[model samples]
Target: MESPFWDMMGMLGIYAPLALGAIGSILGCSAGGQAACGAMLDVESGYGRLVGLSALPSSQTIYGIVVMLSLNRTIEIESAPGLFAIGSLCGVALLFSGWFQGKCCASAIHATKSKPEIFGLSAAPAAIVEGFAVFAFIFALILAGSLPAATGGV
Candidate 1:
């Protein structure tokens, strides 16, 4: 590829993940904070468990990075431009997935704290959030398959 194209993609490759990571961090932190706040609702309740569950949302951030790296390796030059856009979509999904998961976990934490007896109900939100991560990862995997074979040899 031309210098500019590679240059731009190279820059994007780095910046895109960075941005997603930053967003995930912020959202995760917020989710933790919200969970903490929720715990306060019932200090005598599952304060520890609620906090731990709330923190679960932050896990997606690391997963996002892993997905990005995997996509980078999976996508070859043959696919080129098509893969680029799809990869970007996955990256974008990472950012939003973190946010959604965080929110859900936070809400779940709150619910748990308020109704410790119904922890299962509280866990539902986290499950919902997981759907987004699954979708993003599955799409990435599909897109990787669609990528054109690498040109020449490795």
Candidate 2:
């Protein structure tokens, strides 16, 4: 029972993704709630597109989680430790991306609710949120791209 193995197990494993998922879900849900409420208030404005956009924030979070699982599928336990660190960092980015995206969506909805006259203006800020998601996705791809074949002999 070597301690290095245990230390590695604790540092660059499922814990990262689990934390990421939890953070993403909590923040994303809060943002979604705000967006949904705002959209609900603007029932007659035809800004229904915003309602759909509310879910966009969770895209990166979901993608991050999938990437983490996929990496586990592809990478063997014997691979370099650096891969794990990179993957963990990517997961963190994804979590933040989703949280912020949701925030933008919620703000957009709020804007629409307050002034149905400026739905277009509201969309601009929402795009910023999308930018973060894109950044997170690209980072995840970079981290996951270097993975080796699964050690479980998948």
Q: Which digits, one per residue and each the tens of the lDDT, describe model 2 over residues 1-154? A: 1356734653565346546755775787578676676678657656556667676665665666665665554334445354567567766776776687677777777777768778677767657766765676566666655655444623
Segments of candidate 1 deviating more than 4 angstroms? 10-22, 73-78, 151-154
Q: Give the TM-score of candidate 2.
A: 0.70
Which pairs clash inside model 1? Answer: none
Which stretch of 10 consecutive residues in model 1 shows the poorest summed lDDT? 70-79
**lDDT (Cα, 0-100) at 150 in candidate 2:** 49
Q: What is the lDDT of candidate 1?
A: 0.63
Error of 2 at 84 (Å): 2.5
Tell me the lDDT of candidate 2: 0.63
Taking every candidate in turn, the Cα RMSD to the unseen true structure, in Å, is 3.3, 3.6
